[model samples]
Target: MSLDDKNTLAVEGGSPVRNTLLPYGHQCIDEDDIKAVVDVLRSDWLTTGPKVAEFEKRFAEMVGAKYAVAVNSGTAALHAAAFAAGIGPGDEVIATPMTFAASANCVLYCGGRPVFGDVEADTLLLDPSSVESKVSPKTKAIIAVDYAGQPCDYDALKKLSDEHGLILIADACHALGATYKNRKVGTLADMTVFSFHPVKHITTGEGGMVVTDNPDFAVRLCAFRNHGITADHRQREAEGSWFYEMAELGYNYRLPDINCALGLSQLKKLDKFVARRRQIAALYDSAFADMPALFSLAQRDDRKSSYHLYVVRLNLSKLNASRQQVFGALRAENIGVNVHYIPVYWHPYYNKLGYGKGLCPVAEKAYEEIVTLPLFPAMSDRDTGDVIKAVKKVLRVYAE
Candidate 1:
């Protein structure tokens, strides 16, 4: 199935990229990962145990952070960070719309307002200038997401936060292994969050962690994750006391020991996984160098991306087909392409809350042309080739 052999698109009548479907992202798990889980299953404590603390300790050390708080999910990590930062009624948090809803939803969960910031046109990251412009007196924090695994301009963001007396939180769900200015993603912001979903760089089944240098923030995060309780059962037993107090309102956001065991195993392969993703990204860059109708996201010289996604912006003006048509064509050919997101405010829930379109013009425009390609550490060369072929085929068919 060479391109020259086909005169039409797969949507019409031509050879498809592959006979099988390739999803956007997939986890890479090995025997070690399985054995770790099994070992935990045989332990007495499954949810809150020594394994959880061990995972946190290793993860914190891995990222050069003083502390790491493990939680049930990435969303919980965000919620805990925001809550610990004292985000409450009448406070505003600035966040980019070019991310998952949880980035901003965490603000709303804290009874605070989320002010949308536009992203840079080239990198598709939260622009510091845009964030500066959105800051008001009520602004309490900035939740900057490391979109598609590329770290944001932390120096500029830190300056802005300092100038405004605002908390800086990194929603680094996509950037566990990413780096900016020679520093790891976890140590860049006041508090950095990581997701361990199956699609992420590592897997804990369903888990997340928040790492930070501030001892106060770490203590607050721990209490917040455990129903605002001041002590764990282990602490109670050691002190010969059964009494525990709920100091503040909190949720059951604890990450189970079984999941942490899996995470610890996966952490051992983090560097390897990230290297493979970076290799795949480089291959895509080289493959698309000559393609005129597609422009990949700009890679900054100072930042090293984990490449959770390899997104390209389509030059729709040069193509005969609309984005929807191209997306459908790719899907029709078993190429599991997807849009990263609709601007957060574009969702009906946000709309009902008076967040309308045109809030962040750049994000809205980028959303229309962006296409997320398949990129994962587990992808075989054949899988990568299929993605490249499918994209080229779709572009050729839609070329004006």
Candidate 2:
């Protein structure tokens, strides 16, 4: 579809731009996903039932983890992991600034400080070198983010964590299906969290899960997500008992069985979805190769990235339009392009906490150039071509 074709969908010609909006990512739900949800709705239990445990088992097997606990959201999963790792008020957890807010926010929810670690210039995953440099006595964990669905250098990070006696966390929200050195992502860290929000590789209609190999940590996570009760609420209710002991303080972060059913069904199709996404990514990667005004994020041949976002770095000096301008211009052509993130510190909330700008120079630098192109399993080849053409048309004219 060309700009001229997209223009037909426009409500007004005020900007002579098309109105066909393309979002950066979306869920590729199928009839099976619908059927799964419908079945759950018809089941006896709606929340935190057998289906939740099923989903957890399925996901755990998929990721090669020993245990999994479902949560209401990715933030909840992170918070649970942090608490299980024993992060607290005065502790600091190191993480990259390029990730979604939940990665860092999880630490805050547990009353811990999120110390910003710089990202690698190419992959945008947390740079182990920078993380090592930033480590202090207060640092209790390293919340490594798998930016753009690429796995972070977990082997190197593991070594550092072992030496420092720090908990290594995998904020694997973006890289659920990704691999590192041929090992599954979830098994790479002390605790790995997955997100099933609408835009992720799979969705539970807004849910998350935490997976860990440590039996003790898994127990803590399971307990923390359910009001710190040792027994399942459903089990107690079935036993005609109202009495349940609260072993510790916890939150109502339990993921509903209804939602978990959706996750299970969605997981079945995950490989196919990832394959399609990779197909599109290959096309775009080839298209952007040797381009003057744009560069693709670097990847490791040995690693399998889930490709949650197909991000490109803008060569601003060669372009006439700014990053914002390019974004507007793409949307004008009915192509949905978006910025993946701003540095976490740049947000007003972080600013109030004395997290000043320039804290991680590489992250701030990447923020200026990074743009997430529209990529989803359901997108047709035509949609892919449209995005490619729209990008070249809008960006080429501005290129030096």
Candidate 3:
């Protein structure tokens, strides 16, 4: 529960009074994940091999999905899902702006136009009412981001999507272990995507998975991940490799066996990781509960968060200083506080498409007050204390 200030800041151990440096988010790795990769390295296949299939099967079963397709990255999985879902030119895919650009960019990848839907004032997740306002004749899909590992109001969003005859793509990158109304997130959307980057709940170096119950979509996604060429032919070829025809144009987005092995290993510890994360979050929750001057996102009814990134909304009106100053002061204190996102439309790329201002005002306002706090399963109690202490210290100095 301690961090060494004089040495590398990887683990906890510091002076009696020296504050521990807390990171916003990071992955948890154990001997098991490493051993899994080592075992794979010594096996027969390396890339696009047996381990990949094994990982997909286990992961699909974990999330209660009929099938899962592993890809090189979350963005790739999104792109494949969009492509196979028939997102083409002039098609509109509604989403919230409070997420990373990848959520909307995936729509653009398949020549679909990304439409921004405002968020709920509290959760900062896609608002079903706002989403309804953006649906048009060309609307083909709705990609709802599970921001902060909390599932968006899927039941409402589902009704809207169903009414419009649009697909629902849950960018569940932040909600792998999250649940909505007692059901897992992966099974709630038409296509649920997950990320295994170093900063996520798990680590596969760089990997993502697309889960769906539709067999046809699974077949198309599998083909799309491997250059649209059927791997069934490769398995049958013995003497000489027979040429395979492209059922449709696709990309090489399949994840390597090494990454899949790492993911599979990490998946084994998924429950443990989530439990630890919740424990840490509970400590923070208790610490910040009495501080009403701050605005923390409240847990909702019938939902379980994965605690991917525990964000606290700064009550800018109560503080004597601006958000930038407070954020800067925290970083100077080595607290490593970060911002979750800057509304997707605020990015210049989206601006070029004439997605100008005055859209999703709620999300834009949340962006101004949002600050991501350190939350990782590997975080020690001392690390959590340091983050809490740093935050309180900065707020005390900045508060009127």
Candidate 4:
């Protein structure tokens, strides 16, 4: 069909993308997932049980990390990692503002200040140079997030951390199945964190993990998750003693056995799930290749993304419609579109903490045009086609 003919028809819009609705993301749970949870329910142990250890061990092996500590949520994992890294009062941790608030909040939880850094304009990943510019004498750590499942430029980040004698924490919450320079996300930094929320690559209802090669950090993480208690109940009973000691101030961040069982089951299928997500991303990339009004986040050559979110940045200057209008039009066509983030520092709480609009110019500008489309393992080919059609229609109708 002629380009003008296609554009005209789409603007008139006789048919919507799909007859029904599709959420931005959804978990793919099967019979095995249900059986795993049921098996845990039938067992004697629920929280702080053998299943937790099993999940940790298996996950560590999968990611080529020496140790792994399971936690109740991604925020808990980040908090434990930050605390273990010695982030406290008077310390500053550099982090990208393009991620969820939890990434920065973890530093606050440790009584440390979070220094927001601008992101790369094309990749939307943390800009290493920007992070270095934010570093100061009080800087103690760099929490680099694997935004949109793409690993950040770790080599550059590590160099900055080493130069400043700072800890490097990989917020791999969106990048469990991702790889950087052929290494898994879990082993990329000093302490790597993963999330098992329903929208992530794997789901334990709501759980997370911290993986590291340092045994000391693993021990600290364990204690931090259990209210700084030295020994668990099972360990005390096995030693023929009812003695446990509180070593430090910690939070109740332990993941339950039921959730671990589900996590373990989900881990078995992570490779497949990531592959499907990548396929969906490829389809989107191909469909949008020639579209001038939209561009997807750039993937780096040194890493393989897990495709946690297929976000497209609209070229608002080339379009007659604003981002909000296009987003609303897509939703009106049953295309479940959403924005990935509104810069972490833009939140009211952060603003109250003295962080204002100009914290990160790149991130602020990106936030204005970014739109997250429906991309999940459970989405079928037909479903993907619907999303593609819907996006094209919206852009066509709004094209300058």
Number of the top-ranking candidate, with lDDT as the measure: 1
**Least well predicted 10-residue stretch by lDDT in candidate 2:** 7-16
After superposition, candidate 2 runs with Cα above 4 Å error: 1-19, 237-242
- Top candidate when judged by TM-score against the true structure: 1
User: Which lDDT tens digits does candidate 4 get at residues 135-238?
Assistant: 99999999999999999999999999999899999999999899999988887799999999999999999999999999899899999999999999989989
The order by descending lDDT is 1, 4, 2, 3
Residue pairs with backbone atoms closer than 3 Å in model 1 (clashes): none
Clashing pairs in 4: none
Model 4 — which ten-residue stretch has the worst lDDT?
3-12
The model with the greater TM-score, 1 or 2, is: 1
- Of 1 and 3, which scores higher on lDDT? 1
Clashes of each: 0, 0, 6, 0
Q: Please, what is the TM-score per model?
A: 0.98, 0.95, 0.93, 0.97
Any idea what lDDT model 3 has?
0.86
Q: Evaluate all candidate structures by whole-model CA lDDT and list the values in order.
A: 0.93, 0.88, 0.86, 0.92
lDDT of 1 at 55: 95
Would you list the clashing residue pairs of candidate 2?
none
- Candidate 1 residue-wise lDDT, 174-257, digit = tens: 999999989999999999999999999998999999999999999999999999998988899989999999999999999999
Error (Å) of candidate 2 at residue 400 is 2.8
- Model 2 TM-score? 0.95
